[model samples]
Target: MTERVCVGAIAGAFGVRGEVRLKSFTSQPNDIAAYAPLYTEDGSRSFTVRLTRPVTGGLGARLSGVETREQAEALKGVTLWADRDKLPALPDDEFYHADLIGLSVHDTGGALLGKVRAIYDHGAGDILEIHGPGRRRVLLLPFTRAFVPTVDLAAGRIVADPPDEQE
Candidate 1:
C-alpha cells in the first residue's frame, strides 16, 4: 500500500495574495483542509491548504510558502497527498482509488483477465481501465455495482461481471 494518497491538486493562482485554484478529490470536498500539511508526491515539498472560498472550476485556497501569483502558478498541477491513516475510514463498499491501481482482475470462473491499469471518472461514473493479458490491448470496464461485484482488497483482486457478457 502507498504511504500517501493524492487528495487534491493546485490548479493555478486564484488571487494576487498567494491564493490558488484547488481541485479537491475528497468525498467531502470542504474537508480537504482537515488533512493539513499535504505533501508532494516526490516528497520534495509540502503545503498547508486553507480554504479561501469557492470558485468556478474548483475551490479557492491559500497554500503555505506561496506568497505571490507567480509562486502559486508555479504550483499548478502539483498534487497534494496525505498519509493514509489521516483519511477517514470507509464503509463496506467504498474504496480509495490509490488502493485499486495494481490489484489483479478476474472473472467469475476464476479466469485471469489482467491487472487494473487505471480508474477514471468522466462525469457519468467511474471507469476501470484494465491492461490486457500479454499483447492484448487495454479495455475499459465500467466500475459499477452491476459490473464489478466484488473488490477484496485483502485478497488483492476484483471480481468483474461484464454487463454485455450477461446475455
Candidate 2:
C-alpha cells in the first residue's frame, strides 16, 4: 500500500481570486480540508486547503501560496494526496482503493485471474478493473462480496467468483 492516498483535485480557478474549484474524493467531501498540507503526486509541492463555499461541480477552496487566478488555474487537474496516517481507519469490510490496486486475483479453484488495475465508483457502487496476461480486454467486476469473496491484503491476493462471460 502507498503511504499517500489521493484525497482531492484542483478542477480550475473558481473565480477571479486565487480560490480554486476543488473536486474532493473523500467519503465526506468537506473532510478534505481537515487533511491539510496535501501534497502533489511527486511530493515536490504541498498546499494548505481552506474551503470557501460549495461550487457547481465541487467546492470552492483557497490553496496556500496560490494568490492569483493564474496560480490557481495553473494547478488545475493536480491531484492532492494526503498521508495515509492522516486518514481514518476503516472497518474490516471496507478497503482503501490504494490498498486494493495491484493485488493478484484468483478464482475459488485457484486459477489465476488477473491483478487489480483500478477501482471506480460511479455513484452506485465500486467496480474493480482487472487485467492479466493473455487477456485481450480488461475485466470489469462489481466489487461486491458475492463476486469478490475474499481479499487477503497480507497475502496480496483476491478470490473472485465472476459471472460467466457470453462467448
Candidate 3:
C-alpha cells in the first residue's frame, strides 16, 4: 500500500477567480478538504484545500498559493493525494482501490484468472478489471460479495467466482 492515497483531482478553473473545479474521490465528497495539505502524484508540490461551493460537475475550491485563474487552470487534471494516516479506516469487507490493483486473482478451484489492473465505479458499484495469462480480453468483474469471495491483501491475492467463459 502507498503512504498516500489519491483523494481528489483538479478538474480545471471554476471561473475567472483562483477557485478550481475539484473532483473528490473520497467517500464523503466534502471530506476531501478535511484531509488538507494534499500532494501531487510525484509528491513534488502540495496544496491546502478550502472548498468554496458545489459547482456543476464538482466542487469549487481554492489552493494555498493559487491566487489567479492561470494558476488554477495550470493545475487541471492534477490528482490530489492525502497521507494514508489522515484517512479513516475501513471495515474488513471494504478495500481501497489502490490495494486491489496488481493483486493476483484466482478461482475457488485455485485456477489463476489474472491480475487486477484497475477498478472502476460507474455510479452503481465497483468493477474490477483483470488482465493477463488466459484472459485474452480484459475481464471486467463486478466487485461484489457474489463475484469476489475473498480478498487477502496480505497474501496479495483475490478469490473470485467469475461467470462462465464467453464465446
**Whole-model lDDT values for every prediction:** 0.88, 0.94, 0.93
List the lowest-lDDT window of 10 residues for candidate 1: 158-167
- lDDT tens digits, residue span 1-167, model 3: 98999999999998887999999999989999999899999999999988999999899998999999999999999999999999999999998788999999999999999999999999999999999785678989999999999999999999999999784
> How big is the RMSD of model 2?
0.8
Ten contiguous residues minimizing lDDT sum, candidate 3: 131-140
List residue ranges in candidate 1 displaced over 4 A.
Answer: 164-167
TM-score of each: 0.94, 0.97, 0.97
- lDDT tens per residue, model 2, 45-147: 9999889999999999999999999999999999999999999999999999999999999989999989999999999999999999877788999999999
Stretches off by above 4 angstroms in model 3 are none
TM-score of 1: 0.94
Q: List the residue pairs that clash in candidate 3.
A: none
> Model 1, residue 73: what's the lDDT?
89
Query: What RMSD value applies to candidate 1?
Result: 2.1
Q: What is the lDDT of residue 29 in candidate 2?
A: 99
Per-candidate count of clashing residue pairs (backbone under 3 Å): 0, 0, 0
